[model samples]
Target: MSSLSTEHKLPEIIIPEDYNYLAFFISLNCNLKCHYCINLNDKNSARKDMAKHHMDGSDWAKAINRLNIGRDDLPVTLQGGEPTLHKDFYRIVNETDDSIKLDLLTNMAFDPEVFIRNVPVKKFTREAKYAAIRVSYHPGYNDIDELIKKTLRMADAGFYVGIYSVLVPENKEHIDDVMARCKGLGIDFRVKEYLGFDGEKWHGEYKYMDAISQHERKSCLCKTTELIAGPTGHVFRCHSDLYANRTPIGHILDPDFRIEQIFRPCDWYGFCNPCDIKVKTNRFQIFGHTSVEIKDIHELN
Candidate 1:
């Protein structure tokens, strides 16, 4: 993570009009290691290795501030193994342009008092059906009692916070109970569908069935509408490429960098990440949207 040279100003990167999501993986190192973590969906051990080469806060702010995300509805999301784990997390949040709102996806492993003191509440404040700061509730790993206390403290301080947990089959009963308890305590808690395997079968709804089959690698042309940046400031075509540490589509710090909406050749179609191919909701809260569009699919001999 070298900072961009101060001698030259980087060109402004314009976000595509059709882009639905923009995320900066400030750090991929998490305090909690959930068994069903989606970042390891590719089953690659090197996924977390990039955490060491993460661009410092100033570099991240420089790269991010170059973006022209004209729409207020789509905020640049800061997420990772746990975004709060980044050493310069607060600086990155405070340095980003005021025109660009931010959303945080975290595990709530940090002290709320320090977070409230340093970060401005308005940076994450926005109008959305869900809270801007979304916390993941991992049963058995992150204690529910502590999470409840932190959520209450942040909420009382005027920050919109919400807790979410996946509906894994084994934890379904427990999650249901927790959801009820959170709602009763005035916490906005929601249950998300589990998107990985359970040894017996796959548990998610995907647009391309073979993408997550893990049977055989195929060739296809894929185009993505999401802007996913890795810790090293490399922009990837999709989440699969980002987690696998594959050759990036481009670097965010590149002076000539801009969004390319065309489909590119990909040989790892069968090994596509579930997040990219999953039939999920768009920013409008409308269903029936997939992150990447794949075409010209065939087996690679």
Candidate 2:
């Protein structure tokens, strides 16, 4: 498949307090198949991956245009199984306005030469807690030396990039070993807490662990604190869309769609995906954000 580059120059401005942070998964297809792929987990638990579909690049670009975000705040985060794997990857990034402040989450498997020759480093950066481009180091799927070389090359090209590794049980020792090597190379390699099972018991920090086990039938009103989209343009209220492949709250291209930051009714409390209902912090470095909030949903009409 040929890659597409979308180009649009946007003006610089401050982020508005009301603009919601946006995250878009341009494609669900990934180059490296990790054993602990969160998406693949959907196939067994939520039935999401078994019947997943993806939107074209043009559709994604149009979906992004409908969003009203600010330059200083969160621009649309373009991530995926591997975003560069998208046929129109570059086009989607370039076509967006300059004010959008593009951020990319990838495995850095693409040709840096193509990235340098085409994409400007300045396009993906802003004054934020993390770098613009966040790359992942999967011992299961990535070679440390090559990953380091690509990262350093990008940094040399003047891109604000960082590396994060998941602390999978089998790979914990390797992760630490890699972090030591990367630290010496002057690369920022951070370890993220793993949140899935290893065929024994589930892991990670969760507010209500019981909700995920399918232990019993309980009902409550829920609400989302973030914007999450599936491989397709469908926007779901929680990680359940990622796992269950349920109907989306709305499509990213819908102009009338907006975020409602409060609890509402939900009957699927028993099937909650950990990513959504888990307690976490937002862009502002503040805590108390849950992807979905529940309130007296059992009593709903």
Q: Please write out the lDDT profile of model 1 over residues 50-74, one tens digit for every residue.
A: 8667888988888889898888999
In candidate 2, what are the lDDT values of residues 1-301, reduced to their tens digit?
Answer: 1122223322222223543456787776777878887656534644545234667766676666655564466767888778888878888877766766778989998999899988877689788877789899888578878888999999999998889988888888888888898889888888776777677898777776767776666777676656777666677777666556676786655544566665665667766777776666666657766555566645224
Tell me each candidate's RMSD, in Å, in order.
1.4, 4.6
Query: Candidate 2: which stretches are off by over 4 Å?
Result: 1-20, 42-52, 286-288, 297-301
* Ten residues in sequence with the least summed lDDT for candidate 2: 1-10
Name the regions of candidate 1 deviating beyond 4 angstroms: 3-7, 41-43
Best by TM-score: 1
TM-score of 2: 0.85
lDDT of model number 1:
0.89
